[model samples]
Target: MPMTEEQLKGILRRFDTNGDGKISRRELRVGLRNLGLRFAGFRARRSLRHADANGDGVISEEEMNELAKYVSKWGISII
Candidate 1:
């Protein structure tokens, strides 16, 4: 089944270490690792840094929305 919005939100919540209602680069790395999607630490951090829009060290809801839009248009959900 495709991942639901609730599931995604839950995942984000679990990883938002700073409790800022947003996931930072560090959070994403830990979250992905928790999900068994391990990558070289530097590589993962770099990838997330590139994806982060505001450069605030974390990803905001706007970023996630954009990602969801992109995936809906051209990518397949792993779940």
Candidate 2:
């Protein structure tokens, strides 16, 4: 099943070390790693590439849902 925005956000909160209300590449790296995913760094870069619309090098709150969708498309659950 695809991951939901809520689920994704929950994961973000769990891993948002800097508490900056955004998902930086580093944060996503840690998050995906906690998910037991291999190639987490690569996945983070890919997700940022897919979701960072403004090219700001981070996934803002506004881009979270998009990020969730991209991750779901990768068959990775938010949990």
Candidate 3:
């Protein structure tokens, strides 16, 4: 199923630590940990970079939004 606005908003809320409507690498890792996926040290940095946009070395809100679509496409929901 496609990503619902509410679901996407929830995901953003989970990562938007500063309430600034944007997510940094630290925030993304927090969200990943909440989802039961954890990495450490260099691995964490690499993972975040892999998802980053603009090569600034952090996943921004735009990247997070794009990622939400992928997450919803792969996630299974019963209803």
Candidate 4:
């Protein structure tokens, strides 16, 4: 099943190591790795590009929501 917004927020918070309310590239890489979705540098960049809707080089709450939808649509399980 797809994650709820609250569930997604909780997961994102775990990755927000600095508690900055955003996920930086480093954090994203670490988070993905923890989720068993390791990616090389180029692949990581591509993933970030796809999710960074504002082109701010980080994933904000809004972008994360969009990402959650994509993940759900693709049947990607975070658990």
Candidate 5:
């Protein structure tokens, strides 16, 4: 089943451990590992580099869509 944008955003939001309304590198790694992804640390680094357009080193709500797109490419089953 294809994931909707809202669902994707909600999942991304859950990864915000600090609840600061942003997804950090460490949080992203943990989230990916939770999804059973191999090399999650490397993936998180790449995702941060890709999704963090402003180079802030974190994925904010404004940058979430990019994160969603990147994660989707990994074919994650967010069911």
Candidate 6:
């Protein structure tokens, strides 16, 4: 199943270490690692770019939803 808004928020909260309410590229790398994704450097950048719809170098709530959809489509287990 696709990730719910609460699930997304929970995941974001895990990596929003600064409590900024958003995930930056650095935070995304750490988050992915926490998810067992282990993305790095360009790979991490690409992943964030894909989710960052606004190209602001961060993942907002809406962009996080889009990421959840992509993850669901790819059968990625975020838990």
The TM-score values for the models, in the order shown, are 0.61, 0.83, 0.53, 0.69, 0.89, 0.68
lDDT of 4 at 24: 84
Q: Write the candidate numbers in order of decreasing lDDT.
A: 5, 2, 4, 6, 1, 3
| Candidates 1 and 2 compared by lDDT, better number | 2
Candidate 1, 1-79: lDDT as tens digits: 5776556555655777888878766776676677666473554476456556777776677677543433333233535
Q: Compared with the true structure, what per-residue lDDT tens digits does model 4 show for residues 1-79?
A: 5556668657755877898988788887777677776453544566678888989998888788765554444345545
Show model 1 residue runs off by greater than 4 Å.
40-43, 67-79
TM-score of 2: 0.83
Backbone steric clashes in candidate 5, count: 0
Candidate lDDT scores, in order, read 0.60, 0.82, 0.59, 0.69, 0.88, 0.68
Kindly list the per-residue Cα lDDT of model 5 for residues 1-79, writing each as its tens digit: 7778779889778998889998999999999898788999999999999999999899998999898888888885454
Global local distance difference test of model 4: 0.69
- Across residues 1-79, which tens digit of lDDT does each residue of candidate 2 receive? 5555697667766666887887899999999998898999999999899999999998888887788788776666654
Clash pairs of candidate 5?
Answer: none
Worst 10 residues of 2 by lDDT: 70-79
The C-alpha local distance difference test score for the whole of candidate 2 amounts to 0.82
Model 6: per-residue lDDT, tens digit, 1-79?
5556568657665787888878888987777677776444554577677878888888876687766655444455455
Global Cα RMSD, each model? 3.9, 2.5, 4.2, 3.1, 2.1, 3.3
- Could you arrange the candidates by TM-score from highest to lowest? 5, 2, 4, 6, 1, 3
The collision pairs in model 2 are none
Candidate 3 residue spans exceeding 4 A from truth: 1-6, 38-47, 70-79
TM-score of model 5 relative to the true fold? Answer: 0.89
Per-residue CA lDDT of model 3 for 7-78, tens digit only, reads 765765677777777666677667767766535244446645655667776656666655554444435341
